[model samples]
Target: MDYRRLEKIKRILQRRQPDLTLITDNVNNFRNLSAIIRSCEAVGTMEVHLVNNQQEKLYLINKVTAGAERWLTQTRHSSIVTGINHLKKRGFTIYATHLGDPEGICCAVRTLDYRKMDYTKPTAFVVGSEKKGISEEALENADYHISIPMMGMTQSLNVSVATAIILFEAQRQREEKGYYQQLRTSQEIYEKTIFEWAYP
Candidate 1:
């Protein structure tokens, strides 16, 4: 590999957020997944978790991702519960998107605006399928609910778009905290990711 390219990859990997990640629940649409992956890469998030139970197998759409899939680390879980538990064990505070009126609903989670919470913490944002929304298991497993405010008649944004919005907000918060200035990842991970990104 070229020295200049390797140095660039090293610089990027140094800022990769080990504390931040994403968990997508049954988001079967390839375009949405691809867009989400692209946004994740743009924001310096290196890891993404997925829970796909439906017929659709997770695959990268190169055109949609613009080749971002090769750079990200994707972890697939058997179910939402498994994914949630795994993150919890890693000391990450998981926030799942819940965009509905909780009135007349049992076990209604307290939803907060995305900006209200501190995104600089070790966190994982969870998004669900477009049609079904988030699963009950995900809601119960998540530490908090995050909602994106909308003014128009439409109550929700597409899953990929929503993920991008939330993640960018996180990036902004981390930037303010100077999270991007130095290496956040451990030595082993930083070296490994740099090697993979450069060689793969």
Candidate 2:
């Protein structure tokens, strides 16, 4: 194995945020799902929580991910509620991406700008289905609702693009906070990831 390649993977592992992760609720497209996984890898996301109540089947397209799927850790759940509750117990603050009035998502309560929210802590973002958006139960379970500001006639972004945008914002916030500068993951896991990346 090349020492340079090993060093590169080691650097990435050091920056991996064990506290930061993503959740998908009923996203049906394999391409979109794989793209989300690619974005998660780019941002050094530790894990992905998938809620596929529609069916137990979940697929990740290799064409879309271009081999990125093998690098990401994913867990399957029967329902969004179960995933959200588990993350909550693990000290993660869940945020759901939904479109509504910025002043208030559902009512006049006030929705947050994705950039303004603190990502320095344990944060998990739930991106919903392309057609139906997030489920009501998922929205209700979220600690906050976040949205990207839009000005054009079309009010929505593709699920994969939206996931990338929010995750990059999180990457930015975590970078500014020096969250990525220190080692945050367990040594055993880090070693495992490096071996997988380096050997494979």
lDDT of each: 0.88, 0.88
Error of 1 at 158 (Å): 0.5
Q: Which ten residues in a row have the lowest lDDT in candidate 1?
A: 101-110
Q: Which prediction has the highest TM-score against the true structure?
A: 1
Q: lDDT by residue for model 2 over 83-199, one digit each (tens)?
A: 999999999999999876675644554668777788888999999999999999989999999988766888789999999999999899889889889988999999988988898
In the order shown, what is each candidate's alpha-carbon RMSD? 2.4, 1.9
Model 1 has an lDDT value of 0.88
Task: List TM-score per model, in order.
Answer: 0.93, 0.92
Report residue 191 deviation for candidate 2 (angstroms): 2.1
lDDT of 1 at 161: 93
Off by over 4 Å in 2: 105-110
